[model samples]
Target: MPEQTTAAQTARADIPADGAGKPDAVVVRDALGVGIAVGLSGFAFGVTSAGSGLTVWQTCALSLLVFTGASQFALVGALAAGGNPLTAAAGAFFLGVRNAFYGLRLSQLLALPRVLRPFAAHWVIDETTAVSLAQPGRRAARIGFAVTGLSLYLLWNLTTLVGALGAEAIGDTDAWGLDAAGPAVFLALLAPMLKTGVDRAVAGLAVLLGLGLLPFLPAGVPVLLAALAAPAVLYVAGRRRGAGRGGTR
Candidate 1:
């Protein structure tokens, strides 16, 4: 009896803490689900981009290269509104900056070969980051990341081409309410991440700033100004914490 108990303990000890015990098939399924759902939104982008006066190739190129949905939407949305290209690009650049931070965290989690890092960096967008981080173990994380990235990349580009080509047949894309697809998908992904009070506060403030400034400011400028919401919320939170500590002391 004691021998059996000891062996069981040893087996449990050998298991990975991060839930590496999860089957590869399960991880792949979850990753694919996220990838396919988000990738379909690329149709909206392609249609919107083409309707905004971009050529079919240009719409496809943005999906292929820029890849990040929120940033791409912001750029095209601004341009469609007659904003300056430079300002639109700047807003999109600021939005894409978050992916760099995602890559930093993913670098530690993934630990891919040096040769693969550059290629993998392109896939370190929101959906891939979310799926990878949700996995229980390093191996699972890699699987999730790779599957999500590949599926989303392929589908997004493919759908973008179809949407751009069909844009004329679809008539006014905005009338179909397709323009909201990218942001709706993005918000769905983001809503889960605002798990804390601080996170929620920051998001709320960002929404307020973006909406409040939208009428007065140029198209992309509101987005740029809304980026200040994080620092503003953090500063206030920090001061409150300091004050609470002083009172406690």
Candidate 2:
């Protein structure tokens, strides 16, 4: 009886608390949705990179190796503006550093096998992290992370190749507004998650800081500065709560 009970408990633990149909299937569907939507934006990166004087191979290599949209765009955009290669690389490096923080959180959530950790670390980008953390259980999180990563990686690389090859025919990617696609999808995903006052405060302040500093700072530096919004908002909120408790006494 104890054996049967343990087996039943283990099986139930794998299911999502929301009971949203087959949890694995639901996770895959959602992950694929995010993956396909954001992955297509790789076309813009390819076109922009090629237009910025990169060869087709160079553009494709960036997409394949870096796999981070914001960093790739920042590097190419800075180069297009006549920035030094070293400086451009530095800015891109700063933009991609956020992925390391994402990996720290996802390592606990996914808890993948040691053999898979290195490979999984490569896919720890904004979209995959968002999809994995949205899931209710570890099983669902793993499925979401794997599906989102695989689909986005494949589609992004494929579209990047096509875009790089057809850069001349495309003329200017900005005119087509393809550059906005990734951010649009990201905001759509993030909008639903801002369910609390602190979440909204951090997001609002981040936007303000990012946009406000855009004209004054270098490309990726504004984003790095905006990251301060989280800690600033949290500190203020913590002080406010403490003061309220003291007032109640």
Candidate 3:
């Protein structure tokens, strides 16, 4: 017990006092900013879906319930192309499966209150996960998660309504340059988080794989393909390290 206590004390000492390792404010700021920026892109979705034959109510429903940008876009786009609804739903389902992986990482990290976690699960998309994980501590992570999720949900729905109502006059949301804002903001936040060479490599590989597969594969398949690159790289790296150590032995 004494030895365990001493080890615990040493670990605590290693952590920098007052967040010398990570700043809390910066994480919160990034989360809020990213959420708003991404939420704004819902305007584009609203217009796009309306143009694609979705009613204003239907578009708003998707923004409210589906909540995931990529999957919602995939579903609408597929249906617009006259694809079967079940097939479209399946594609969207595959796209959303990535969030479950995010939830796995988060559940272990945040350890949120039971009352809050189920509600929080609805917000476990790309932006929230990125912002929360960027935080250095549990408190910051929870704040980041809640702020991003709430901000995105509210703003996305509002913008969706605006775009749906003004779909004809608004013309192309892409032409106004709103289309790229969310992804650009997300990438900017994510870039700083890729501190290690291995992390950068994994990100680069995922990007390459995802974009490369996008034109040929279905909408969600590219995301899944990109997801594979990180684990595959890690496995290969581990094997190489083992082989090098075995050779040295």
Candidate 4:
């Protein structure tokens, strides 16, 4: 009991003393800003999806329920191309499965309550992970991640409704550049989050693979291929590099 008490005291001491217990306004603002920016990508996705023949309900459902902009756009694009809904769903499912890995990492790091675990897992998306990891301080990461994720989720759903309804009367969505929104939004959202060589390598390889397979593969297949290939390549590369540096277990 004494040892446990001492350890608890030591753990508390590890928290920074200066303004450590207070909310970090700067980090919170930055986190919220990142979420808002990424949520714009969601709006862009809605616009593009609307242009691609998805109904307003479908766009809103994909944005609100699915909530992964990339997968939503991919699924919509596949459907627009007359691909099977099952095929589209499979592609979207695989791409979004990476979020489960994010949830695993976050569950260990956050140590959230069992009741809240489901909510946290749902919010563990790409932008949330990026914002959380980019936070400068330890506590800031946790608060920022949760706040940003919740904020983005709500705002994204609301704004997608706005975009979906407004897009119909805008006359040919492609003519208004709506069709280009998805790629542009993706680029903008990803550029700020990439902070490492491995991230860049994975992105570059995915892009290359996507381009290579797009012309030959069926709808949704190109991205699916790249998604599968990317992790394997990155894992092999990381292992090789670790071995070269004598850091492997």
Candidate 5:
């Protein structure tokens, strides 16, 4: 009996704990939560865009064509401030550059077929990346990415229409605290993924860099600079590990 008990205990120890069942459903739930949160921010964007002298159609076109929140905001904000068109576009373009990095990471995570990859590039934003990476496996990641991308695209456009049509009636959305919803929702979705010390460290450094640069740089440009925090942290960490290995031993 004692020998049998010892063998069973050893077997149980070797069997790894399985991930939660119903991973697809879990992915959908998380993706939807984040998608809705981020998408609804389009209300603020619409109001701001219209207030900046863009017609409703023009505002909608920006959302449709640009499909990038920070860039859209930067464009409208710059125009409203009477800044040069070229300068506004430069800032917006830099902000969107981070999406290229996201695409590289997601190309591995998603493994979508060649036919779909081009369309998928439109979905490679911060929110989609966060939700997809939070999933346990490839299937869940793809499902999460698809759900987030599709849901956000639909809701954002719809809300943009609503906000544009009622821009006068909506008054100041800032009064309603809608402006913070995007970041607040994003942090909630991202909190679970910051499980490792490295993740937390990178995030902390990013926050510091972003905030420090915000005062000196244009709105979109600071965010672009802040995106460097990831590669900077990784490079320093790699160098430290190599040093610890004593010149490749």
Candidate 6:
């Protein structure tokens, strides 16, 4: 609930102004709603994580501090299946690779100090990065991203206790579609990013590739393949469009 005045100067003064487009309270409210809405995915993750042998404290800490759904899921899944610590760590890290790409994309928009970079980097997970980059104004984007991230982090960690205690009664996650909740959240967030036909088509290609590869690939490999394929297809499509325009010109 930062004021629209010089509050920007306190922690985020380095964020460059964009043509007098400052963030309003309404934008912050919408961003908060987005965070709360997307946080349903965390409930699924929490139940899964706790049921997989993670203590309530562990699940809460990871959700609050780490704040990445896929990574937490991978960690819990690996450990539950009796994976060694090394294997579990590896699985978690692999799932976390996408966040590094998010960092690279968002680093351009951030102008914070070296000390702040660590926290900022930690906060820039998939949802935050998507919301920030998708927003229209820089201030609004920053506010949206920060508020969404903070709100989710708090709520997610708090909800893990309920999940850990309640998962037994809840029974099989697959039957309840909780397993699909995470992907549904991703799709919900993705809707805003698909503003153009090319974006939509690329997403379609990725889904098709994911479904196609699920049978042949190992547990996590199909997602990795789809991740690589979707971007490459989009890049090639963009180049073709550019080439066509050049020929016409």
Residues 1-249 of candidate 5 have per-residue lDDT tens digits of: 445566545544532233345467778898998889789889888887777678999989988878888778767776766666776787778867868988987887676899999999998988898877677666778888999999999899888888788888877755665445445655675688799877998899988987898677655565567668889999989989989899778
Query: TM-score: which candidate is best?
Result: 1
Total backbone collisions for each predicted model:
1, 0, 0, 0, 0, 0
Candidate 4 lDDT over residue span 1-249, tens digit each:
444566545554544323354468876887789788777666666776777788889888787678887778778878877777888888889888988888866654555679988767778888788776665445776787888888889888877877777776676665676556656666776797568877777888888888888788777777778876567777888788889889644
Error of 3 at 135 (Å): 4.1
List of clashing residue pairs for candidate 4:
none
Per-candidate Cα lDDT values, in order, are 0.91, 0.84, 0.78, 0.75, 0.78, 0.71
Better of 4 and 6 by lDDT: 4
Q: Among these predicted structures, which one has the highest lDDT?
A: 1
- Scored against the true structure, residue 139 in model 6 reaches a CA lDDT of 67
TM-score, every prediction:
0.92, 0.81, 0.71, 0.78, 0.70, 0.73
User: Where is model 6 poorest over a 10-residue stretch in terms of lDDT?
Assistant: 11-20
lDDT (C-alpha) at residue 183 in model 3: 50
- What TM-score does model 4 achieve against the real structure? 0.78
Instruction: State the displacement of the C-alpha of residue 248, model 6, in Å, after optimal TM-score superposition.
Output: 6.6
lDDT measured at residue 36 in model 6 versus the true structure, 0 to 100: 82
Error in Å for residue 213 of model 3: 4.1
Q: Which stretches of candidate 2 lie over 4 Å from their true place?
A: 1-23
Candidates 4 and 5 compared: the better one by lDDT is 5
Off by over 4 Å in 6: 1-23, 53-58, 74-95, 134-138, 231-249
Give the candidates in order of TM-score, highest first. 1, 2, 4, 6, 3, 5
Model 5 stretches astray by more than 4 angstroms: 1-20, 172-249
Model 5 clashing residue pairs (backbone): none
Question: lDDT, candidate 4, residue 198?
Answer: 74
